[model samples]
Target: MAHIMITGGSSGIGLQIARLLVQRGERVSLLARDPAKLEAAKHALQSQYPDSRPVHIQAVDVTDGAALHAAVMDCVASQGAIDTLIASAGMIVPGSFLDQTAGDFNSQIDTNLIGVANAIRAVYPSMIAAGRGTITIISSGAALLGIPGYTAYCASKYGLRGLATALRLEAKPKGVSVCICFPPDTDTPQFRQEIAQRGPETKRFLGPPKPWPVETVAKHIVKGMDAGKGEIFFGFDMMMLDKLGPIIRPILEKAYERRNKKHIGAQEGR
Candidate 1:
């Protein structure tokens, strides 16, 4: 059984991934900021896998590099050096660029981008010396293009793509592998919160297909990790965008232009 460490493992995709790994008899540890949530996740896992060892957990925010490193070491001492690291903790706030706060923008970068770096930095040396490991960064579809109300979120996730790209090159020769997943909107607490925060403008820009269930998203991510894929993308649309993002952006922009003009005409009763 491999020892897997997941940040943000108390809930959403992180927790679901842990469930899958545990079901397969892997040793798992969790890191998240909320003690109550972490404790609850631990109990839930233990209840499900009654025969397995207790999952180690730490209540620490990933944005704090030093604290996160210490938490990782604590898990390492308890379970073993983490053979797999999934950096899945992230947040998004939807609003027009002018309405987004400077603090919120900086927070997204720190938590999503720098936080990922910290998790990677904590485990990278050990993985390199051990000569084997996997690191999975959970980016988003927003990373590939500009979203109407996700300026900061897009920037942070895009940073993750770049982080994984460079790290993949450095890790391959050392027998460590890096994978980045671009999951489209997934139904989770975070997504619900995002929906609540979205303004009419934001909602107008987004419609149709609902978010994928968190279970499905987690399953795909785990399967990708199991297969050692360097990049994991769910859904045909996402795969298409990954292949044709640059080419497709212009088309989407024109559509957005037409949609905006129509909205303006309606507002003016023209």
Candidate 2:
């Protein structure tokens, strides 16, 4: 069985991914900031797959590099060498760029981008020595465009895309495959939180929140990873965005601007 370690594995997409892997009889190690959540996730997985290898849980904030590294090491010690590392830990703050503070940008960068780097750095040596491993990065649709309220979120996810591109070049020669998944809005706690903070312009441009189920996304991601795909784009919208993002950007921007104008006018009238 493959030993897999996932950051942010206590909840949402991460937890769902763990559930799938455990069902497949793969050993899973979950790293997250909340100890209670971690334990709860472990229990849920164990209850589902009682005969599978014990689920490992480590409580550590992804933003804390040292703590993350130590937790990763402990996970490795308990689970043996990590055959796959899924960097799913991420955060987002939705608002106009002017309304968002420097701290908002920094926090997203530190967790979404830098946190992935730290987790990779911690487990890279082991994977390198083994001369084979898979690294799955969970990016978002925001990485494709500069959404008004998701300015900081866009920056962080865009940074992840660049990181994945460069890291793949280095990892391939070492027999490591890096897979990046660009999932559309997923129905998760994080998405709910993002919606609560979205600006009027963002809300208008985005329209209704039609999110894919976390299980569906996890299933696609795991399948793509197993296929050794370089990039995994879910849904027609995401596939189109991946291929035609640059070509259609101007049109999208204009459309969003028009929506923003109407939204701003409505707010003023109210």
Clashing pairs in 2: none
Query: TM-score, each model?
Result: 0.98, 0.96
- lDDT (0 to 1) per candidate: 0.91, 0.91
**Model 1 worst lDDT window (10 residues):** 200-209
Which stretches of model 1 miss by more than 4 angstroms?
none
- For model 2, how does the per-residue alpha-carbon lDDT over 168-258 read when each residue is reduced to its tens digit? 9999999998999989999999889887877767776778889999999999999999888999998887888889988878888898888
lDDT of 1 by residue, 13-79 (tens): 9999999988888999999999999999999999989988779999999999999999998998999
lDDT, residue 200, model 1: 69
For candidate 2, the lDDT comes to: 0.91
